[model samples]
Target: MESGQGLGELIPPLADSDYYLDHYDDLSCIITQGLSGKIIVNGQPYEEEMLALNNISLAELSNLINYMNSQWYPDKIEVNLNTIKAQLANCAD
Candidate 1:
């Protein structure tokens, strides 16, 4: 878990569900578990220690996705507008 470690490298194996659930926040836990599932489904060797980090359930990911979609659209628009404004200012000078 050092700075700049890739996320896939930090995920725990499917066997360590309890450990993962205890440490991470709900959203992070869900994403981590989802990633772990992907690894397991793909037949990769899932790490065990990393499982001590996040244990999010399937229902939670659905809730998180809905929440994120609600929040993301407005923020995306604002960011695009700001970027355009900044570019326009740069061109003006």
Candidate 2:
């Protein structure tokens, strides 16, 4: 997906990563919780403090929740699930 790159080109490079190859939960964390905060995302900066990770979009949130439910991480799951769930639940149906 890189500039001027084909799908095959991308796969070969990423094939070396253990994080990419296994530990699929790591991606879930990155997608759900994101890599950083300070940047406003999903109305999070105004809503509340998110420690380091400040935002994830609603679609991303949905993916994350589903991912969490699918994979079992025991004690390491959900660093910010409560806040996200609270915000989402308050949304109009």
lDDT to native, each model: 0.37, 0.41
Candidate 1 structure quality by residue, lDDT tens digits, 46-72: 544434323544445445434443443
**Model 1: lowest-lDDT 10 consecutive positions:** 72-81
lDDT of 1: 0.37
* Candidate number with greatest TM-score: 2
Residues 1-93, candidate 2, lDDT per residue (tens digit)?
Answer: 333121442121222233333534344344444343243222223223223233666566655545544443333444355555555445332
Model 2 bad stretches (over 4 Å) = 1-52, 73-93
| lDDT over C-alpha atoms for residue 40 of model 2 | 29
**Candidate 1: residue 75 lDDT (0-100):** 33
Superposition error at 81 for model 2 (Å): 14
